[model samples]
Target: MRRLGLLRLALGLAFVAGVSAARADGLIVSLSSREVVIASNYQGGSITVFGAALDKDGEVRPPGPYDLVVTVRGPLETIDVREKTRVLGMWINRRGRDFVRAPTFLAVLTNRPVAEIADPATLKREDLGLEAAAERRIAGAGERPTPEDAAFVAALRRLQEGRRLWREDARGVDFIGASLFQGEIALPPNVPFGTFDVEVRLMQQGETLARQTTSFQVVKSNFEARVAGLAEDRRLAYGLVAVGLALLLGWLASVIFRRD
Candidate 1:
């Protein structure tokens, strides 16, 4: 009995150590200098993306004029694990309300003043099929979602239900970060020039867990700046000169007519 107890204690400690190492930090998301920006404080009691083993060396490169979203799961402490019981099914529903008045918006701005936006689909928890999944496992209702199962649901939502942009913002371009539960996104050069807004939201069952918003500016490239500044070649300068000439010509004509 004493040996068995010691073995159980060792296993328990190992499991806890693994969980702490996994959940030690949250994901911090950023873009490659000129495009995407994350706009909110993510340190509050929310899910973070730092614990997973990803193909970091093999991660896809981001494009210019793009948006990046990062999602994380696990690395749970006893408290976070305990809260998962309360947050799992209800998070989507609660978080969804913040965007109820307006569609959740993510946008990329360009120097050209056009915006590419992705809005999130408005869905309730039931719409997310969580209801059915929950129903199928009455036995598992008392159990927490295994990391694999939770990750699968998050992946499914990313593929099937994202928002479409009806009116793009004045920024450049943007892409939807696949999932709030866990993932990251990158913006690329196809974007124009203005402020790109990065928005991340966690929603379960159509409610929200949290929402974050930030902006990144896209300025003229060195080539673009030089071209824009050439007084002899600038169209705006030429147009202004032409307008002045036209006004002067009209004044001279009027003066000559009046003298006659």
Candidate 2:
């Protein structure tokens, strides 16, 4: 009888440990830089995002066949998409839809094909892929989108891709060993200035084991900052300054090309 009681207690303790291990399987993510400066002559740059897996005891574990996904999203903005119609043999904008709080920039990096990592429903629920991201509609869309609305969304995605503001790289993340992984995200020259969120997800067997998020700032340099502040805080003064500069440039041009 005592032996039976001891066995039951041992089984219960083991079960509790197993549950704790499952709960502790998590990811730790970090970025090389927390802030990025966009100077007047800034073109573009890249940031390194890296992370490791943590065991139940909160210790780094040997690297496994874990999948990693890194997503960088910029500040949201209201986007207006206009559809054109041919009128009198000329194309003219006739209808438009406004997408409020749409991400101005989005870049994704994955160790493997996203389809192989998660199902369509899971991907859509987590916004894990480009199609999922594009399908995300904010509030005030008035009604559920129709086929035409989908077409407009596709057009907008194409435009973003052309500008290099949105991208997806299949081989972007690389695993260094059993426990560590890293990825790179390219910041285009035209990346908007604002706070950007970076998300790292670790998945196994089509299940998200852990996820973490970090943030960084894209800020203008001193000169650009001053100009932006003036434009926002003192619009009249900014306009006057712009006009003064234009006049000065015109006068200089006239002198340089004076007929003699």
Candidate 3:
């Protein structure tokens, strides 16, 4: 049994070594901050989210709430991110600046706030998830929404249902926190040593306005052996059985001694 176990471990190591040469991509997006606080009164105006720009060695902070600042470098419409609670939309209390502030207006600009974009790219209407007219107005709002804009309005309503999508405006900014957004993706033990794709997106209303796609790779530089082998052989299988027996024996011994 021990020989079989050793053989299985060796084979597992060999397979891993072969895959070690395989490479993967690590896509790191450095946002303004991983955490942020949207005061109650951030009403629907140009909103400003802050954080560092993207870099090779991205910034890291202890896990907590943060607002990821949006930074794009191209002719593409840039979208920002903010938090919104149930009561206070994204508006800041203009008066106190400490509490959340809800604007009197029923509807304000649902999209586009304080903006710094590289250049405008062809707005993918599909990404906007707006009807032809609403997408047109938002992409190039000449005036009030056209009949086509109804679709756009509906899209926003749908987005508000659960509030999973993140936005830049103050509309729902007050209730948000870093916990709402995604953090790092963890690679599994036998994650076929290679690059994996990580997708990041910006949604307004219910549509995707912009997207930043990147990848992350796992290297064989640091590997632990035990995790690599439990999958393949009966030898390791027997080891598990041995562990179970040992645990049971210990429990039984403890019970007998306690009774005495």
Model 3 ranges off by over 4 Å: 1-196, 201-210, 217-240, 247-260
**Top candidate by TM-score:** 2
Error of 1 at 207 (Å): 0.9
The sequence of per-residue lDDT tens digits that candidate 2 reaches over residues 1-260 is 54643344344335434433223347766666778998988989987776667777877777777788888889988878788999999999997767677778888899888888889778868888676677665334433567777787787778888999988888988776467666777999999989999988888877888888878899998999988999999999999999999999999999999998
lDDT of each: 0.32, 0.77, 0.31
Q: Is 1 or 2 the stronger prediction by lDDT?
A: 2
Off by over 4 Å in 1: 1-29, 32-189, 229-260
Q: Local error of candidate 3 at 233, Å? A: 4.7
lDDT of 1 by residue, 5-82 (tens): 344434433543453322211222323232322223221121112111112353333323323222211111111111
Which 10-residue window in model 1 sums to the lowest lDDT? 74-83
Ranking by lDDT: 2, 1, 3
Q: Once all C-alphas are superposed, what RMSD does model 3 give against the true structure?
A: 20.8
